[model samples]
Target: MRQVPTPFPLSQRIPEETAFDRRELAAILSLYGRMVAAGEWRDYAISHLREVAVFSIFRRTAENPIYRVEKRPRLRQKQGMYAVIGPEGQVLRRGHDLPMVLRVLERRLIRSVD
Candidate 1:
């Protein structure tokens, strides 16, 4: 039998999907749990795509997500891999560190009551 060349090299292959690992999820969930307890967020969705992974926070089931946290490895060098986007599609924060990027959202949790 003749040898057949593979489309991709053995050393390198296309990423099937990008996902959050246990540690990353733990951090995100910690924040999520706090928001849930604060009654600010009600639901959430997670998406793993070839280029990016997203964790979306929703205030209700039917409406759009209030916030979207994304991980883009491509931007790891220039803009960092982590980002938090607001509902209006604005980049609320971006950084190499997940906790730092998430601080923008955490600020909303802080409010004094009369």
Candidate 2:
């Protein structure tokens, strides 16, 4: 088959997909490991979309995500790129720093041994 050239330039021709870099994934996975050890999280999933990258945490494989850590580059200048969302579709925290935003969940982990 012959290739058909589009009107858009080479930069526009390529589809953009958002994703987590190694450092970002490292931080997220570090928290995930702790949560798993604490028995707060079990199953997990990662999604890379055109607009956002998401890491969903689940208590069980069959259940909806208990939390979602997402990165939206568009929001970087406005409300920051990193966000942590709760199960009820609420934004738990949003910030320019991934570790800072993740502190919301860390607080929960540090509270009460029970």
Candidate 3:
């Protein structure tokens, strides 16, 4: 049988999905757990797409997401790779470090508790 050429080289194969790695997920889950215990969040969904990974939070199952945390590797150079988006589709924060970027939500939690 004749040899068949592969469409793309092994090193050039594009990723099928983008997802939060173990460390990133751990951080996200930590905050999520706290918010849930505080009665500030009820439900959440995680999506791994071709170019972005998103963790969406909802107060109620039927309502829209109250917040969305995203990771885009493509933006790692210019704008950082992690982002927190509010319900209004606004960028609450973005940075190279996930913990630093998530400080905005921590501040919200503090204010709510006060």
Candidate with the greatest TM-score versus the true structure = 1
Compared to the true structure, candidate 1 yields what TM-score? 0.92
Candidate 2: segments with Cα more than 4 A from true spot: 1-15
- Mind giving the per-residue lDDT tens digits that candidate 1 earns over 1-114? 999985878668768999999989999999999999999999999999999999999999899999999999889999999999999999999999999999999999999988
**lDDT, candidates in the order shown:** 0.95, 0.93, 0.93
Structural RMSD, model 1: 1.8
| Candidate 3 worst ten-residue window by lDDT | 105-114
What's the C-alpha lDDT at position 74 in model 3?
Answer: 88
Candidate 3, residues 61-98: lDDT per residue as tens digits?
Answer: 99999999999998999899999999999999999999
> What TM-score does each of the candidates earn?
0.92, 0.86, 0.89
- Top model by lDDT, which number? 1
lDDT score at residue 73, model 1, on the 0-100 scale: 88
**Deviation in Å, model 1, residue 41 alpha carbon:** 0.3
**Residue by residue across 3-47, what tens digits does model 2's lDDT show?**
998687776654479999999999999999998999888999999
Backbone clash count, each prediction separately:
0, 0, 0
Tell me, what's the RMSD of every candidate? 1.8, 3.5, 2.3
Candidate 1 wrongly placed segments (more than 4 Å): 1-3
Clashing pairs in 3: none
Ranking by TM-score: 1, 3, 2
